[model samples]
Target: MAFESLASRLQSAFDKLRGRGKIDEQAVNEAMREVRLALLEADVNFKVVKDFVARVKERAIGQEVLKSLTPGQMVIKVVNEELTELMGGNVAKIAVAAKPPTVVMMVGLQGAGKTTTTGKLAKYLQKQNRKPLLVAGDIYRPAAIKQLQVLGEQVKAPVFTLGDQVSPVEIARQAIEHAKENHLDYVLIDTAGRLHIDEALMDELKQVREVAKPDEILLVVDAMTGQDAVNVAESFNQQLELTGVILTKLDGDTRGGAALSVKAVTGQPIKFAGMGEKLDSLEPFHPDRMASRILGMGDVLSLIEKAQEAVDTEKAKEMEKQMRQGEFTFDMFLDSMQQMRKLGPLEDILGMMPGMNKMKDLKVDEKQLGRVEAIVTSMTLKERANPDLLNASRRKRIAAGSGTSVQEVNRFIKQFEEMKKMMKQFSGMADKMQKKSKKKGFGLPFMGKSAGNLPLKERGPGFPFNFKPPFK
Candidate 1:
């Protein structure tokens, strides 16, 4: 929910033109006015907002839009393209050296998550079969080296530290040599940061940049800082000549001003975004996907990628076969929950699907899901494979074991039975579904309707714990 407020406002502005056959100048102007106010309210740079509005208005009011069969949709398309261009038109990839041991200097202010981001970058690189060595170059902050070392261990990357007793500049210089000796492909130098930019900090960073001769100098800025994030990027770019930017806290309760404003302000592409605190949460910044998300169009590619990463292909095929055979036991239910949890939060998954933003009012209590998993876990294997074994006393025992009331266990059992029946129906057309999709994507047992044929309880938006949406 990076641009929760801004996205809602923009969606509302375009609502007036939703069904209009012919988009007039008056309609476009009104929408632009709302867009302008929304961007300003989100703390976007004044100049960036003005220019963006101008560009969007120019295209929106043109004859081409007026001539389109679906002018309303055309106007939104123009805005989406403009928004994508305003934030770097494509993914800015990291620099690869002609020689191995590509050096990257991480520079930023304190609290911008420089250390955590470094670890994430290491993880991202390793996913691509690249060997990376993390350098503990932030000696000024107490325990900075220890923190990087811990992250290095977590990511399974080696941490190169010269100890706090040595200068960071020397540590960075030596880290490159160490990477060369170890045949590591990338050396990430986690440089020191300050509360604010100062001559001392800049000088130290410059020295590291000089000695390391980094292939990439990335400025990590906190996206929640709004305009201040842009200012920080500007300051760092002026001195360090950053090759790209890394935005942290983009997944937090941010207005998303920094993401929209930083590139336009500093003339730098955002290479990566820190989505969450998890080590695997750092993602390559995709401008078009981000623009689509802001407009509530969804990021289908990213969703598929997350699904593919989180799911085991072999296990997925087996699970689908079981579901098709009407053999979805409680054990399978627990396994599905574990796999879905690996795809980050359920809300984030919803945000990546078209029109799901409208269900913003719907909340998925992950803790409640955890409790459901606990209920399944508390069951004995025999009880899991055969629900009939769970008689009154057995249900009471399960309730006690899972730290819940008997009524709760009964409610879960009822929902699971409903879901199992639905899966049987789904199995009837399994071959047809398999033909349509390359393979079956992960399914939520009792969540999100698969289609009109799929049933949703009249009592609530979704069954089981009732993840109710605002709409009926």
Candidate 2:
């Protein structure tokens, strides 16, 4: 939710235009004025905001938009396109060297999360089937080498270190040789950072860069710093000639000025973004998708990618089969919840779905999931498989075990029964639709021919508890 405030403001401005049947110059000017204020308030650089608004206004007031059948939508499209261009127009991929062991030197100021980002980047490269060797090149900070070693162990990547006694340049030089000897495909040098920019820090980083001959020097900046993040990137790029940027703490950056302005100011594309503190939360930056999200259009591509990464395809197919046959059990429900948790927070997942931005007041209580899990876990295996065994006495026992009232337990059971009925109705409806599609010699919309070919199983007993879907 990096751009939550800005998105809300922008959407409000657009809503005014959307309400009008025909847009006039005055209306466009008014909307642009609101947009300007929004950007400025979001802490975007004044020059960048001025230039962006100017470009957006020039195109929006053109005959192609003002004379269009749906002028409001046309103006919105202009803003979206310009916003995409304001950030890097295309995705900036990580640099790959012609030779083995692509060297990536991570550079940033202290407290910018540079070391953590190096670990995250190593994890990302590992997922791409590259064996990465992490170099503990930061010797100044207290326990920096130990920190990298801990992270390296967490990611299962080997850490190359020469202790704090050796010079960082020598450590980096030797680490490259170690990577080559080990047949590692990438060498990530976690360089030292200063509290602020200074000549000594720049000189040290330059020396390390010269020794490592890094194919990419990524400047990791904390997105929560707003415009200061952009300034940091600018200063680093001026001295080290940074190849790209990695904006960290983006999930907590509600203003999003850093993400929107860094590329423009430093002339370096954002190669990756740190979505969360988790090691696996680093994701390749996609400008178009980001623009879509800012405009409340929902990032479906990112959502699908998240789903593809988090959900097991084989298990999903099996789950689908069970749902169609009305055999979804408490065990399956627990498994599904665990799988969903892998995709990140429930609120964030819901935000990725189309039209969720309109429901601004929708609060997804994550603690409710834990409570349900506790309730289910309190039940015996036999009780889970056979809900009819849960009489009043059993219900009271479960309530006591789960630290809930008997009335709450009864409500949950009733909800589960209702869910089973709904699932059966949906299964029957899907069967009918598939049969009709077969007769028509085509597949159903969204769902293809695969929907018709699923092997059905015999229905199983329903668990008697009502649980709301994870996303409200």
Candidate 3:
């Protein structure tokens, strides 16, 4: 949902120029005026906005081939490229020390989600088969230490705490020693946060840096802070010599100006994004993909990565075999739902799916999936594993247990039957598509989502259409 407003406005402005064979100065001027307003409304820095508009105008006006294609598309492409360049032309990877115990110090203001991100980074490292030690370095806030402890428990990472009596620098030193003694692969120090920039805080962080000698100093900033976030990044980077930034609260209603301006302002690559409060919500930053999403073009690679991360390949193969054999039942459906749930929010996952958002207007009854799950759960093991045995009495029992009427249960059964039929029909097509993808070297349909049908679902409850019409 980052840059939702800017995306909507820009898409609208470009919509009017789609089919134009020629573009004149007046038409280009009109589009630029709207774009200017959109950028300002998106809370972009005034100077950045001015420079962006000027560069865009210079290029657009000089391009004499405006008569060949709609000027709006050309402008959109230019804006996308400029935006990508503004955010950092390339993705930056976190620095991992060649030696063991790659230290990463997390620094940020209070309420910036630094402590949580520290735990997330530990988990991320652990996923890479690294033994990470979490050092609770926040001395002021007792809750901060406890939060780190809880996260350590969640990720099964060891936590080092000095019980608020010792200095953060002392705690960090002890933690590094502990990491060295235990042969830990990484040490993530969660440093204290201040309400604002202060000399005392900076000095304390500097001392911790000296003691820890972190390979990566990540400046955690709240993306919801807008331009203030960029300012904070600049201030922190100036003093701490930050290696990268972790933009937290990206799932919030952030205008995305900070995300777009941070690298340009502070010259630090955003190494990771805090998508949610969960431990697994952290994502590696990808500038080009983010630029595409901001332009309402969707991020296909991210979607595929997420699906691959979430889906169990062995389970998928089993399910595919079952579907091909026309043996997929309530158990398989429940297993599929559980697997999808591990991927996180339905909307976020679906949004990444190609063309899944195209049916937003049909109101793809997400609750129906929940209802189906509940109904299946209410069934006895025999009844659930064997759907054909769900007679009238069984249906009534399921409805009562699931807090629905018998009619709803029957409807769900019928829908499941339809799904089974569809799967049977899709089996051959899926195989053919799989072969085509192998030949083409790209994921086939349903491997990921497309952005073309955003605000629309590929298949909704009310609509029976098999094809998505061109949204634009």
Which scores better on TM-score, 1 or 3? 1
lDDT of 2 by residue, 38-76 (tens): 999889989999999999999999999989989999999
Name model 2 segments beyond 4 Å from true: 441-472
lDDT per residue for candidate 1 within 283-337, as digits (tens), equals 9999999999989899999998998998887886787567657576888877777
Model 3 stretches astray by more than 4 angstroms:
64-71, 353-367, 424-472
What TM-score goes with each of the models?
A: 0.92, 0.94, 0.87
Model 2 accuracy (lDDT, Cα): 0.86
TM-score leaderboard ranking: 2, 1, 3
Per-residue accuracy of model 3 over 144-243 as CA lDDT, tens digit each: 8898999999999999987899998899888988999999998999999989999999999999999889999999998988889989999999999999
Q: Say which prediction, candidate 2 or candidate 3, comes out ahead on lDDT.
A: 2
| Superposed Cα deviation of residue 22, candidate 1 (Å) | 1.4
lDDT at residue 419 of model 3 (Cα atoms) = 72
Q: Please report, as a residue range, the 10-residue window in candidate 3 with the lowest summed lDDT.
A: 461-470
In angstroms, give how far residue 322 of model 3 lies from its true place.
Answer: 1.7
Compare the candidates by TM-score and give the number of the best one. Answer: 2
Model 3 TM-score?
A: 0.87
Clashes of each: 0, 6, 13
Candidate 2, residue 73: how far the Cα is off, in Å: 0.6
